[model samples]
Target: MTLLQAFVTLPVLLPMLGAAASVIVSPRASLQRVIGVVTLALVCVVAGVLLVSADSYGPVVAQLGGWPAPMGIVLVADRMSALLLLISTLVTLAVLVYAIDQRISDYGRETASTTFHPIFLLLSTGVSLAYLTGDLFTLFVAFEIMLASSYVLITRRTSASRIRSGMTYVIVSLMSSLLFLTAVGMVYAATGSVNLADLAGRVGMLPEGLKTVLALLLVVVFGIKAAIVPLHFWLPDSYPNAPAPVTALFAGLLTKVGIYALLRTQTLVFPQDHPSTLLLVIAAVTMVVGALGAVAQDDLNRLLSFLLVSHIGFMLFGLAVYTPSGIAGTALYIVHHITVQATLFLVSGLITRRTGTVSIAQMGGLAQTAPHLAVLFAIPAITLAGLPPTSGFVAKLALLRAGAGATPAAEIVAAFVVLASLLTLYAVARVWVRVFWGTPKEPLVDNDPNDELVVGTARSARGMYVGASSLIVVSIVIALFAGPLSAIASRAGDDLQTREAYRSAVLGPDTAPGGPGPVPVAAVPQGPAAAGGGAAIGAMTADDAEGTTSR
Candidate 1:
């Protein structure tokens, strides 16, 4: 294997190795902190290198253990994977620094510093692995790795509430994982292969009935992970209770992974001749429902969680449009959302740390006391509401343009998207009014008297604020550099529309050089008719819908 390939794989491997090494070498709190910071720094460096290499050399694929594609495990880094990896690494590194700062105050420095480092590194490893894996089975394994590590991180302090929330998170994640496993098993039984490239090649040949079933199953599994409307109940329940740093990472990275899986599997593996109107309808409802839930929430974390769900539907709208513009918009939205969401969560954590509560009703006039915190929160809040001069604006514009050009139903989808953004604006504004604009309801409290030396010291909360600001700055950077980023996104969308690029990159160039293979003939049930009363089954063509093609 080439040195570049080895470098690409180390981002995933280093964290897992670090997790174990941290546990074995020394349980010293200071040592663990050093190890965690160093390990994540290395990861970020590797991720940066990979992104640069991908930009110049195209996607990098490494056969695990030197086994070739289609028969052995493979890790591939395309534009999409590379971009997401960079975002994830930045979020992890920021959170790690914040965690180090808050270790003693939140959980005793000894326990918080040691336990968190190992689990968090493991979680980072799993997230990286999930993004890079080329095979469906490896994706599942990565999902488990992430879920397991997160389970520990969520319940790190083991409080009653933390344990309860962690249990809910664990149960919901495990059930989704099981459903995903079942779907994988069924797909393997039907197609005789679990490789994503191979599955993409064979999906069109499967009977319409089985194809519909597999697609529906996948939607359920990914929906659970993405926190889509009805399936999103667990997020508000669990996210607010974890450590602030853990919550930041969860808000920023985990749900996006689900969205990534949905986009990857739906568009890449199961290319359909016609777009699924069902997904379009669900996207609309998800946007409206999630926003309404956010409006009802008074807790800072719960509000952000609901908004996360609502924003996901915006991305879904782009995916539903099944156009290059829509896909590109979704890609941009993913980047925008990750940065904005992480910033908000970290800010919320700061609020909780200072005021000793996340309840909006119990906190007020934070802007006066902590002007920096207020500014940090404001940036993400405005961005989340899709205000101008932000990446969020660019993302929404792409979706609106796509929706305007789509069918009549797409017009309604566009309307819902707009309304959802407005509602998000209202919700965030309400939090602003309640938490920052009013008279101070209570003074800041230092709960740990023994830690007086660090209490209100520059090192403790400053690190948290710095982490939050760093992410907000990234959102601004994305907005400023929208031209180049949009160009890359457009190329990604174009590549997706023509699956040959992806297929040839994953499978060999000789395996269907120009387009996907012929459609398969396996039999399964079909979904209900389209929303406009059109028949679900109709004439098929290679380029009839986004990503659909005859093998």
Candidate 2:
């Protein structure tokens, strides 16, 4: 295999290997920390190289087990997946560092537990698989891996309240999984294959109603995971109760992974010539509702969780526009949100360490006492609010420009974007004035000593600050280098919308969608009717059935 192909698998494989090694070296906290850090750093490097290669050479394809796509496991890294993977690895690395320090600070150096590092690495593995996998079934498997690891992380060292919240997260996640699996079965039944490039060709031949139903089904499945508006109820309760670093990781990567799935599948299998009106409406409602929810929240983490839900609308809005510029805007927004949201959550953890409370009303005089922490919080806070010269502003501007065309639907959603940003500014400014500007308040009494997030001392916060600050610097750099980054995002967006390059990369050029080449006899159904709705209604011949694999 070529070096680029090798780079494609390393991002996923390295984390899985790291997780296993961490488990074997369990109970040795320091060594495990080194392994986790080094593994993630290497993955980040690989991801960066993959991004450059993909941009220069089109998608990088790696067929595992020496089998071709639609028959065996396939991993494809295009500009979109490569960029998201790179950002995810970097954010997870920073969060892991903050988590390591928090563990040592709350417990001790030798007392830090073993499960955290392994489980965290597993979470990163799942995310890598979700982004890199070239088939729908593999995506389902990736989501399951992520859900399993998250279940353990959410409930680890839990109190009754956390257990209750974790249960809500689990039940909702399982329901989504079942729905996702059902959708996969439906797609396989309809298209005779679940390989994304294969389906990209075949799904277009199905009846319009069936295709629409499948598209909506996948949207609902991913929407629940992305925490978009009406589907986001479980998130506010579930995320805030976890230890801060875990919350940061989830906020930064989990929902965005869901958005990535939406961007990937909708553009490939369910390509639309016009912007989707239904998606646009959902995006507007999500933006308005999430911003309003944040305004009412008193707890710092819960408020940030609400804002996380709110910004998901921006990504959705970009997708709903269904233009290359819209998709590019979404790409930029995801990168910005991943870094800024994670930084905000980590800084919230630092504030909890210093003040012993997450309640915005209860925190006071941080600007005067913990001035460094206040500065740390302010930068991300303003970025999250989409103020000028930050990554958020650049991303939002892209979305606005994309939606600035003649369509009323795009115009309406663009207005909602502005309203949401204004509300977000108000909500975060309230946090700033309430938490950082008032007379100093004493630390809240440790009502729940079992909750490590609010019970930790600030003595060992230097590493935590470093972790959070690294991302803060990343967010700022995104602003400073917005031109090149925006160019990359635009190219990635064009690649996603075009679909030809991706299909060519995954299923060789001979079998790429729309290519002037012979179709795989097993891929196309027998008759004209069979080629259309025939497959959906059991039109596959015995020989064809024997030829196709479950993947």
Top-lDDT candidate index: 2
Q: Kindly report which residue pairs in candidate 2 clash with one another.
A: none
**What TM-score, over all chains together, does every model reach?**
0.90, 0.95
Question: Once model 2 is optimally superposed onto the true structure by TM-score, how far is the C-alpha of residue 241 displaced, in angstroms?
Answer: 0.4
For residues 1-551, could you state the per-residue lDDT of candidate 1 as single tens digits? Answer: 38888887898999988888888765587777788889888988888888777767677788888887777888888777888888788888888887777765545656634566788899999999988998899999999999998998888657677788889999999999999999987776556567887778766666666788898899899899989888999999999888677888998899999888888888888765454688889899999999999999988889999999999999888888787777788888898998888888888877776676667898888899778878888988999999989889988988898789878888889999999999999999999999999897664454444421122232345676677888888898999999999888877776666666667766767785445463333221111122122122322311233233242
| Worst lDDT 10-window in candidate 2 | 542-551
Candidate 2: where are CA atoms >4 Å away?
A: 515-523, 526-536, 540-551
Clashes of 2: 0
What overall lDDT, based on C-alpha atoms, would model 1 receive against the true structure? 0.80
